[model samples]
Target: MLVKSIEKRVQELNGNLELSLDDIFYTVCQEYNLNAVVIEEALGCKCPFALIGFITTLKSADPGNYIQYKY
Candidate 1:
């Protein structure tokens, strides 16, 4: 269900500005009225890496927010 929640949130926040994985996760939590600790526990990951991996999948699926990099 967490992945579903993430997908939905990413869709909702696709416009305006591109957000980092951490921002997306927090936004999803806020939007769904979920506790961060609860989510982390459910995912068995207390770090941002897990969420970043999920966000990468989301970008591949629905890449509305353009990704860019600078060297």
Candidate 2:
């Protein structure tokens, strides 16, 4: 369940920006506590480029860590 949410969020983030496979994997692991191997296998990317791209996109979209709304 959690993994799915993380994956969805990653996909959403990716959709917003141009992130590499690695960037997505790393961000998922670091921010969402997802397994690297699982994400790699799922995303089919071995390099960190994707994860970097994802992070860059996330950072750009949500700078200063400001919360826009609360659930």
Candidate 3:
């Protein structure tokens, strides 16, 4: 459910950032073999709005690098 919500959000984006928030999420999960649900819930965000703020903050932290729709 968390992954699906994020997918809808990313579909509406321009994808200018090679590494979007969704990418970071999945990568962190895969790289560390963590649980997606547990990690996403920890974020405590509502999709498509506050979530963007979270993403923005992440982008600012590292400049640019996020995406997952390539699959």
Candidate 4:
């Protein structure tokens, strides 16, 4: 799953990725090649804020250290 893959990548990166919200949104959208609406529905969130919250909840990293999709 994407979430699991992201977790694994983050772990491999060793620590936080430190990216802007726009970078995150764009990366996810491009990676999945999904529209914003579809992304929101898939994540069970109505908006970007909620989506971020949902993603954060699924990962083991702290808020400050999450969203780090690196090797």
The RMSD of every model to the true structure, in order and in angstroms, is 13.4, 12.6, 11.3, 10.5
Q: What overall lDDT, based on C-alpha atoms, would model 4 receive against the true structure? A: 0.49
Better of 1 and 2 by TM-score: 1
Query: Mind sharing the TM-score for model 2?
Result: 0.42
lDDT per residue (tens digit) for residues 1-71 in model 3: 44444445455452546766566555444543434454367466323344435544654464223332233
User: What lDDT does the true structure give each of the candidates?
Assistant: 0.55, 0.53, 0.47, 0.49
Against the true structure, whose TM-score is highest? 1
Which regions of candidate 3 are displaced past 4 Å?
A: 1-16, 45-71
TM-score of each: 0.42, 0.42, 0.35, 0.34
lDDT of 4 by residue, 1-71 (tens): 65565445434333446755445554554554435555555665433344445565645645332333444
What lDDT is reached at residue 42 by model 1?
49
Off by over 4 Å in 2: 35-71
Can you give the lDDT of residue 53 in candidate 4? 51
* Candidate closest to the true structure, highest lDDT: 1
Residue pairs clashing in model 3 are 19-65, 19-66, 20-66, 20-67
Q: Scored by Cα lDDT, where does model 1 land?
A: 0.55
**True-structure Cα RMSD, model 4:** 10.5
Model 2 lDDT at residue 5: 65
